[model samples]
Target: MGLLAAFTHTLEITLPVFLMVFLGLGLKRLGWIDAHFITTASMLVFKVTMPALLFLSIIQADLGRALQPDLIGYFIGYTAISFFLAWAWAIWRHPRVERGIFTQGAFRANNGIVGLALAAGQYGDYGLSVGGVLAGAVIVIYNVFSVFILSLYSDEVDTDFRSLIKNLARNPLILSVVFAIPVALSGIELSGWVMTSGGYLAGMSLPLGLICIGGTLSVTAFKRSSTIALDASLWKLVWVPLFGVLGALAAGIQGPALGIIFLYLGCPGAAASFVMAKAFKSNDKLAANIIVITTFASMFTLSFGLFVLKWLDLV
Candidate 1:
């Protein structure tokens, strides 16, 4: 595609995904939904719909082809390096209390929703298959890293090793992927009705999650942007993606693998960062600010990045 066509294609994929978020914001402002609804719906997405999505997608995928060891290894490495680098940056520039929240914001991303959507849009079935497999790794690594960092900075958050293990064991997202992999590898064929019902639930994940994200966004948070929040947002959108894509290129990753990495890494600060911050008695407002800023800014940066990649024929 030409440069204009590449950018237009990028928009065509991203705009619809982001529009749901805007719609959520609009509904919230109109009082059609409130905080209670966002909380309930977000819980539903996290505990139910998203797990269904992951389970069904992984079970249906050709795992032998979809599971790329090199890609998974690279992603995990990139995420770890980014996590510690962000932590170091936070320690250097932010107050002690805000460091963990800022660090998580800088590296954690809404990969399951935004990244998956864009990857599917760009690469179709191949994208979904590969992205789904990659998501298994993403979920485990992101949560572990987030909890570890948050606990380091927050006295309120439980630093117990057993508690962390228990939470990870109970995490629906992680369990869904864990269960699905064996079934997938064994080539178990599910019944038609089961597939149909699962498909319905799976279809609800991204849109519902996007809307919840939009509903969670706070105008007050955006207005309250501090240097800490702004810097973290910058790291989330700009620095993280730059280093990730560059590393992918240097490592000779190309096509869909490179594209998927770029998309996932480039995703905005996850809305969950705010929730975790609040739960850990960290600076939730700063977390919210980072989410708001990165969420808004990503509409441009993600598009531009994809456009350049397309123009260069790198993905």
Candidate 2:
């Protein structure tokens, strides 16, 4: 009964989150959301709300435990290994452009709003801190490698080392973590209304963020490239997570942290891949396929990872 209950609740929460995303895609098909709305929502989330959420989350975190570079190293190594395998596989299967776009989908898991909400629910602020750092590392290496590999195979662009480094250096997630360091190190705290209000606002981060995330999906993209979508899905939703388990073990990562970190990497590729593809003049269809396929497929991979975690008594 306990097993059944746990299984049932996991389905209840996880499935609804995914369904909301698909429903957003369906709404897009009905013209309920268009270019204007997506742009506005993205800007609102990125420039303001997202940062506030990050600041609030990080402000309360015990930085000492969270800054465990050993764990960060495991995540970094695992990220590199997964990315290398993805690059190798995609190149063998597709051409330069297609491979570059598809490769990112396989390894660049979503660590955005939805992932944060789920992790916070299960592990509170500590989990968010761990997940955030792990996420930060993954984003850094993923963006660097993806752009570099694509550039190596493609033609000219105005983007130079300086510009690229600047963009990477100012990456929002990276910036959030970096900025939080001073606050964490000062051993200071938010005072009065700042403390009271910030906590409330921070509480808003998870659910509201998930809803906005659901509102952001696009059905049209999902139906665009079945081949790319299917291929990316199979590997991201299956192979990547399996590989992550082995990599985590090899990295000497143990306990609940290992599973949480690994499970996050199993998430579907972010929708941001489309923007990156356009920036690099890569295959947009493949990028959309990656976004749609891996996301839908990840519903399973995430659950399976959790099941493994439970089996191993890790979480």
Candidate 3:
């Protein structure tokens, strides 16, 4: 496609995803939904709907063809490097209380929700298949690092490795990917009703997650954390993707693998960052502010990134 056509296509996919966020914001403002509903919905999407989406994506994929070893290696390596770099930067620059929050915001992405939606939007099932694998891998790294870093900076100095392992084992997304891989490898064709039901659940994941994201955004936190929020937003949305895509290209990554990496890199700081911050007694407000700003900023960055990628025929 021409640049103009690619740009249009990019917008076509992204605008609706963002529109749901705005719709969610509007609904919350109009009192159609409140904090309780948003929290509940977010949990439901995270625990149930997103797992269904991942399961469907993986179970239906031809993993022998779709799962690229190089791509997986690159994703895991890039995430590990990014996590340590962000953590090192935080330790070097920030005060004790804010270090974990800043580090988490810098490297953690809302991949399962925002990243998957954008991938599916641009490339349909192929995108979801590739993106789901990447998400499953990256989320494991994300959770492990998040717990470690938060624990490092937390007032409670003792880190529970066992609990972390249990949480990782029990993670719905991780479980979905694990369970689906065996079935996918076995070439067992699910019943039509099973496929239909999975599709239905998968379809609900993105829209519901987007709305919850919108609903949870807090305008009040902006003023208090504007500087840090903007800084984190730039790191999350701009620098991360810029360096990531460049490094991936340098390493000869291309096609859907490259596209999935770009999508994950450009995704906003996850809302789960705030949850982690709160749980660890780090700077929760700062984490929330970073999420809010990065999310709003990503609508532009992600669309532009996709347009550029499309123009270059990289995705």
Candidate 4:
């Protein structure tokens, strides 16, 4: 009972992100922002603003305290398999263009919100940093895999290499990580003024991102697609969590690593799920529902997963 309460406590803290998501959806219903706004907002968060956030965080990280082999191994086992498995599932769902849409539910996740919230609760900033690295790697892999999946599901035999190149070129997170790698090696510190301003800007990135997300949750997407959402809930909410847990354990991670994996595994599907759906012109409805449901469902699994961790005294 005590264990369950601890899990729920953490979950309640994390639930606000969904409310923020709904806030975005509500704003969209009122026609305050549209798809173009979502694109713009996502771009801002992904490229310039959020990259600054990652660079600052990663830069300040105590490298000696960071970098655990078990954590890396766990994420490798958990995220890699899920990344590929999602593609295989979508490919097999052929003829149903909705498969690509549902695939986003499978492949994408609410890592930033759910994972960070839980990581902070469990491992504090240390755990969060570990989770962040894993999340970063997974995001890169996910981008690559999702593109390939879209090609197969879209049945595009001659996918333009230019498109892939452009994506990598424009991605802020990737660029920030690349930039940080060199700076991390250099071991230089940012000026006080720069740190102060960057910190302010970085703070704005997520809350603004959430508010924008809240503004763009489409009513049309909700009303239009039912079956696609059902499929998403089934696989993303249930199957993915199951697979992620077993895979993490099988890969020989425990303690902080295991806790971090559970936090990530318990994340609701990504808010970006809609992006993949629209890009492929697949089941946008299902993708949205999958995002919504998995997010809500995470309140349960996250709590349960956290409870398990608490019982094991990992935190």
Return the top candidate by lDDT: 1
> What TM-score quantifies how close candidate 2 is to the native fold?
0.88
Residue 70 Cα positional deviation in candidate 3, in Å, after optimal superposition: 0.7
Question: Across residues 30-59, which tens digit of lDDT does each residue of candidate 2 receive?
Answer: 788766766776666565566666776676
Q: Check candidate 2 and list the clashing pairs.
A: none
Candidate 2: misplaced stretches above 4 Å? 19-23, 26-33, 156-159, 200-204
Q: Estimate, for each residue in 1-315, the C-alpha lDDT of model 4 and write its tens digit.
A: 476676676666566655676677777877887888878887777666767766676677765555666676666656667766765775676346655566667756777645664565566667545655666666766666666666666753445668877877767776776677567668988899999998887666666677665665554555554765766666766677667766666666566777677677767777766676677665556667776667656666666666666666653
Give the C-alpha lDDT of model 4.
Answer: 0.66
For candidate 4, give the lDDT of residue 85: 74
Segments of candidate 1 deviating more than 4 angstroms: none
Candidate 1 has what TM-score? 0.96
**Where in model 4 is the C-alpha error above 4 Å?**
23-39, 87-96, 112-114, 155-158, 223-225
RMSD of 4: 3.1
Predicted candidate 1 versus true structure: per-residue lDDT over 1-315, tens digit per residue: 797888888888889988998999999999999999989998998898888988887787778768889999999899999999999998888899888998999999988788887887888777777887787678878888888889899977787778778988998887888899999898889999999999999899889888888898888889889998889999999999999999999999998789999999999988778878887888888888999999999998998898889889999
For TM-score, the strongest prediction is 1
Worst 10 residues of 4 by lDDT: 216-225
**Per model, how many backbone clashes are there?**
0, 0, 0, 7
